[model samples]
Target: MTNHTILEPLREDQWFIQSQELRSFLAKVSEISAHTVDDRTQTLARLEPYFQELLVQQEWLPQKFAQVNPESRMGGGIGQWLLYRAKNQSLSIFSLVIPPGSTTPVHDHLAWGLIGLYKGNQEETVYRRVDNGDAQGHAQLQITEVRRLKTGDIYRLLPPDGDIHAVKTTSQSASVSIHILGNDTGCIWRHQFMPESHSVKSFRSGYSNAPCEEEEEKEHALH
Candidate 1:
């Protein structure tokens, strides 16, 4: 099995600054509070434009980045690479490569998030956390819904909708996704996804897969 090389560079900042579409997204996002049930539906609506913009600007994302099967050793498992960050507020962009026959463990976000699919197809299983801890010390996690997303699609996950889900990539290639979240100078916590174990945990750690040490060091100094 040969490693599938990314022929194109992962372009960031192509869609960072505020645009007409981004402004519209922000409007919808402003309507929902992190503390309310409306946050789920509103956030998804707001995220659609960003995803659309990314697809329009970089059409090759979905066509070129397909999910690879781990068995074939052609593609790797789900991993993240942070693209950019700023003072006060930070932007984190990551690519989630899901190999065929491999799925992400169910998890939820500690902060607001937006996801867009660049290539292939994926099945998302949404879950809700139940507060009633069973006698076995395992918390009750419920599967609420399942959604199938294809290339050039986008969505949002928030705490209000109980945004815990498992993603399974379609066959033929690896499924790649671009995720964006706000990280306030490492003040915001990160939500970790555990697919096999079906759990998510929160942490206040710095970006693990940031672009480079020198760049990260500079950013840290400014913060």
Candidate 2:
């Protein structure tokens, strides 16, 4: 579904955080065929109840996430890692950890996305693409809604609901969440919007941690 080299696996260096519950979730994700966007949406919905259990278990997270500094200018002032992606056009799962005061630039996901907050707090604003006035070929976005999410809050970003938004950590501690998206998001050509200039730019956010040996080889070949 994405335009980049596909990565397939359940874990890499991220294995240190795996649990039976997570493995079970992966098993369900594996059954998904990814034939259509709606099909994938329903698939993720089926696991919503189990995903709550994941929110309750906070010990499995890697320590590196807590150590991440919100002030770091690196990687959008946050930490992220790609835990898995289906070999074919199935799904991509990743984690985003944002420390207090960390925020991301306003952007849009070309594919469907679901975010489940497991720790701390966050505030997000959703935007509607009102115009594409960027002479340089970018989108113009308008804020549609703003919401604060706490642990176990699941936010949906499917079409028809204005999928563009900017996210920020509002808690004193680091906020961690599981982001499950359609296709390979890290390598896909998504939109990043500049509110001041009213411009948009294409961007691809690569994996923050590291992929497995097989995935690394495939990624190298793509380059």
Candidate 3:
């Protein structure tokens, strides 16, 4: 089967912004202001459907993100595209296409995030921040859970909800997802992937071997 076959088929009309669930989710996310864990969780739950709807509408996403390139300052990979950026509200929507044997670095966002799988299968491993040192030193992070996501799956990441995770495509085919987040300006603090020294290393260490060894090696040397 082709990579597109991995995606759940949908009617053209379904892509319209008519679903009550989606509308409600957008309303909640758009209005969320409180930074408390409880409040964030509630807002994320309501916004999950928006992520789902975007993923379901992938048929038109490429054209919308035609101007995006993975090598640009935004930093993404082949088949990955950014659809829109609302820097003023600290929100951005991204459509990722993961080629077979490809993987994203283990990273964390500055704010909460929502992910909806539209195409193929992906494996997600989440981490939790932990206090490992005195107040004068930095705390450590730990891997807490691992999940395998396929088409039609939706998940949230934030303060209360799990947010720190690493993802990998399941096969040679592409896996697509819609990412909604609170920060779009690219000014937020991004957690760098410290694979060799991080507290959470085992969860994503062996899942998928790197496909571009030469490029990865060059990047590693630069780091």
lDDT, each prediction = 0.53, 0.68, 0.54
Question: What order do candidates take by TM-score, descending?
Answer: 2, 3, 1
lDDT of 1 by residue, 68-172 (tens): 323321123554433344332434454567876677655545546688887778988887776553333234567788888898777776664646677888756
TM-scores of all predicted structures: 0.59, 0.78, 0.62
Per-residue alpha-carbon lDDT of candidate 2 for residues 33-101, written as tens digits (9 for 90 to 100): 343345656765766666677768887656774455344323546766766666553467777878788
Full-model lDDT, candidate 3: 0.54
RMSD of each: 9.6, 4.5, 12.4
Task: Report the number of clashing residue pairs per model.
Answer: 12, 0, 2
| TM-score of candidate 1 on Cα atoms, chains taken together | 0.59
Where does the lowest 10-residue lDDT sum fall in candidate 2? 7-16
How do the residues 7-102 of candidate 3 rate in per-residue lDDT, one tens digit apiece?
121222112123454445455556663444467677676666555665665454434332323453323443445344442435555566665666
**Candidate 3: stretches off by over 4 Å:** 1-38, 63-80, 87-89, 132-139, 185-187, 199-223
Give the winner by lDDT.
2
Q: Looking at model 2, how many pairs of residues clash?
A: 0
Candidate 2 Cα outliers beyond 4 Å, as residue runs: 1-17, 32-41, 65-76, 132-135, 160-162, 211-223
